[model samples]
Target chain A: MGVVFETVVISFGILYRYNLFKREKERLAFELEINKTQTTLQLIATQEAERKRIAEDLHDALGGNLASIKMNIQNMAPGNTQLSTVVGLLDKASEDVRSISHNLMPPEFSETNLKDLLANYYNQLNNRGSVRFNFHTSGIDRRFNKIDELMIYRIVSELTNNILKHSHATEATIQLIYYEEYLEIMAEDNGVGIAPQISDGIGLKNIQSRVNYLGGKINIHSNSFGTTIIAMVNYKK
Target chain B: MGEKIQLVIADDHKLFIEGLQSILDNHPEVEIADIAENGKELLEIVRKKKPDVVLLDINMPVINGLEALKYLKREFGQIKVIMLSTYNEEHVVEKAKAQGANGYLLKNVNKADLIQTINLVHLGQSCFPYRLPAKQGLPGISDGFLEQSNITKREGEILQLIKTGLTNQQMSEQLHLSIYTVETHRKNIMQKLKLRNPAELMKFIISNNL
Candidate 1:
């Protein structure tokens, strides 16, 4: 009886320790994986930066040359029909290149107040069609560090575009509230709500990605009323 | 009749700075009031310029974008900020949003979108890619759904990590546990909370203001 009891106790101890050890190993691997993912993400960001740099170079360098060539061609050979046609084609191609380059690099953003820029677009939207828009500002105290404001402005604008295109709504509201500790951005619209059974969502996914990148939380409500996105961003300087 | 949208952009990249300047230079109304190379320079400029909007970057050289943003937001609560970055990391975006960025956008965003956001920000609007929140909640949160019966210390650790944006592998490495153990802990957490997936977890955090 005593030997049996001792054996039982020893086995339990062995099992507990084994489980603990296994858990430890798993944790180490998990950490490694997280590190790997972070590194991968960093690499991706670097790649994106490089791509933008190339686009910028192409725009300033190649774009300039192309524009100048078109100018020279136009100046020299309006009389030469063949040359004119060729130059016209080249000019069209150059315009396309410039557009593509601008798309890749995002030129106008860097120089403006991100919020104002977005608001201008919203104004345009409000002016153009029938979408009744209301934009409110609350947390107007804390201006972001370099390059931060543009990101915020762009994201808000994109959401508005999405709403205009997909929501098919007549009215939308955007609110920016600045809290003592963090910031909150709320956008809502009244239209036909999203279908209940959404399985393969791509736009929502993109929105999710952008929200995730901000390290913010987004709430999407698509009921009979419409779609609402309320995002909360924690302030971590 | 349009409000003068006061603005500032802070970044270290000279080429991008120049490009932005050249483009906005054409906009007769939209003026580039002030531009800085890094976070510190940006802070000083903002202090002086007092623009209504400030565009900040994430990864700067001296103090980094996040830190600078934190400082600025704390000091100037009225100025709106939008975080700009080339990468699209969810957690980073979340962090920026949390830290009070009025908006978030990718560097590869459209020029029209960029202009539109400035207007949006000026108009006092906020935007981001939207996602659902997590469902299952804190240990003692609301509906008594979580087991709350006999959760181990390890289980609690795993929950905290999950809330902090750490993946399963990250939890394992941080806690010195095996992948299997972390997975098991996750299972146990879900089972206890009666939660389904990560979305649920996120929801719970938001509902509880975690």
Candidate 2:
């Protein structure tokens, strides 16, 4: 009887030890995951800050100088054909700089809300007439925090750009649904769906990273007729 | 027309300001009353000099051109303001217009157009670029005519207005041009197109699909 009782006690002790080990392993994994997220967030923030600095330098220094050069050239010889050609080149250069800087850091990002920014972007795309884009929203009259808004904007931009470049889609739609606790984003396109092999492409990967940073879940559905992507992310009022 | 038009220029770039000054030196009608390096300096100078027109740069230090424009419009309602910036974005232009800017010109504006815009703005007229729709078929056909007839861009613009059957006075008002200038452009258009009269001009316009 004593031997049997000792066996039972030993088994219980072993079982308790195994459970503690498993719990510790899980805690370690969770800590590693948190560290990874923090590192990635820091990297992204640093990259954004660098981009903003470069954009400002480009706009303020290079753009201003180019404008000054054009003005001086025009003043030197108003109607000289050769100077006019140079001015044209300068204008193109200035435009390129402006576009590059604008893309790096949109000037309206700080001033305008997410909806306006997306609307402006969509309007520009529609005006190009290459791909028709429609945006729909519900319960989004209130603005989200800038960081969340920016992340969502990036996700949508990546999705639409992917569609425009690869999906061969003539029409696309982006819908936003805001709930009390979280927001849902759905991007749909009427085109050949994403190829299975290209599902893990850089664009989608970047979007996945953003969604993960936002602590969101994303699902992609693709078939011959079209592709639809849905992402849900929590937000604070 | 008798008194010289007083002007105050505001831009952060000294080189750009000097270039503008050199260009305006040839035009005796426009007198540079004062120059400001930024929006703050601009307000101070405007208050002291009371210039007739202010060439305000959109991007500036301390206070931006748009804000300065608002203050100017509210405090000194008589002073005319023109937004001179490299940014030709539609929203910026709309904001300037909404804030009572008399004219909006890109930084690459030629000397002739710059002087003319200032003069028009001083004459109580507004001058803004006519943004044609992106998908419009008119631009292509208009470009063909311009290339074939050696017509200047300003003439092309006037031709489009003429196609709409606008009178000389109406064209002047819409384009911020004097009636005499409108008549001159009309004569030049007729000469270039070899049209005898307004009827022939209309016929030419239809035949060319311009």
Candidate 3:
């Protein structure tokens, strides 16, 4: 009886130790995943800060110099044909540089008119002729915090960019539906769909992280017929 | 002319200052009263020259643009300030506006807009070149929120000293206060800013562009 009781206690001890180790392993795995996501988000934030710095430099330093040069030329020769030609060329160069800088750093976040911002964003895509975009919005009359607006803008922008790059379909649609509790964003492309075994590339990861940053939910539906990404984020007012 | 618009252009970049001078060279109603490399010198020149308009850069070596604006408007209310910033971060703009800045213009503004904005500000019209979205209602530095929080001037000074890596003893010496007084001020600042510790305070400062 004593030997049997001792053996039973040993087995129970072994079982408890194994369960503890397994739980620890699972916790560590979960922690590693969280850390990876955090690192990716930090990287994206750093990239944005760097881009803003560079864009501002380009817009201020080089663009300011060009404007000063144009001013000097205008002051030097108001009606001279040659100077006018140079000014015209300078004007074109200035516009091109401005567009590039603006693209790098989207317009200031305080632009209150969502419709206007969307219009400008879509108009910018006119340079890329192959992609046809249809944008629609509803129930978006209320204002959102600046950070929230920027995040939403970035998500839509990235999703549209992905569709343009990966989707073979010539047409895409982006919709923003605002409800009392949350804002729903949808991007759909009628082209080749994402594969099931596809790894999370930088683009998808960026979208996911952005959605995570906004404390939102994301759903993706992909098949041979088409692909669509739907994200819902609360207005962090 | 009856009187040229007296202008003091304060920027750390000498070349940019020169470029701005050249742009304003032939203007009929504007004159370059002085050029300052930093906020300290800008304040000195403002005191001496009493310029009608001060074109101040946001990023400077000693004392940033927002602080200078605060001091300038507080000391010389007649002098109009137009902030010249390379980037239009919304918080910075809102802060400048709240600090009594007469106008805000991008550093890359064309000569025409720059001149017009300066003239407008000189004539006592507030101007903001960038469009802030309507309805978001982001608070400014001196917004009602700050007023409600009741952060004192001493606390603000201490917060700035903390940001500059000044120890309590050093801050006390700089501000002509006792070390304990400086410590009290620091504690109050943290409380007013709703920061739990130094790390949180620093994060708050960076995030808020303070």
lDDT of 3 by residue, A139-185 (tens): 64455765567677888888987887788877776767666678877
- Best first by TM-score, ranked: 2, 3, 1
Residue pairs whose backbone atoms clash in candidate 2:
none
Candidate number of the best DockQ? 2
**Cα lDDT tens digits for candidate 1, B35-142:** 888899998999998888888877577877888889999999889898876534345576788898898866544445667887888778996745433222333433
Candidate 3 residue-wise lDDT, B1-210, digit = tens: 539999999888766776788777868989998999999999999989888999998878799888899999999998999998765445557678989999998765666788899889988999985552332222234544444554443455666677888988898677655554455456545655567888998897677665
Error of 1 at A172 (Å): 4.6
Lowest lDDT 10-residue stretch of candidate 2 chain A: A134-143
Candidate 3 local distance difference test against the native? 0.74
- Name the better of 2 and 3 by lDDT: 2
Query: lDDT score, residue A185, model 1?
Result: 66
Cα displacement (angstroms), candidate 2, residue B202, comes to 56
Error of 3 at A30 (Å): 3.4
Which tens-of-lDDT digit does each residue in A1-237 have in candidate 1?
A: 999999999999999999999999999999998897687567646865776788767765565455445444444434789976877686566656665664454544454454554454455456566776666554354456433454455457667766777778888767665655656666767767666554126666656665665677877666555666766666657
Candidate number of the best TM-score:
2
How many clashes show up in model 3?
2
Chain B TM-score by candidate, in order shown: 0.62, 0.63, 0.62
TM-score of decoy 2:
0.71
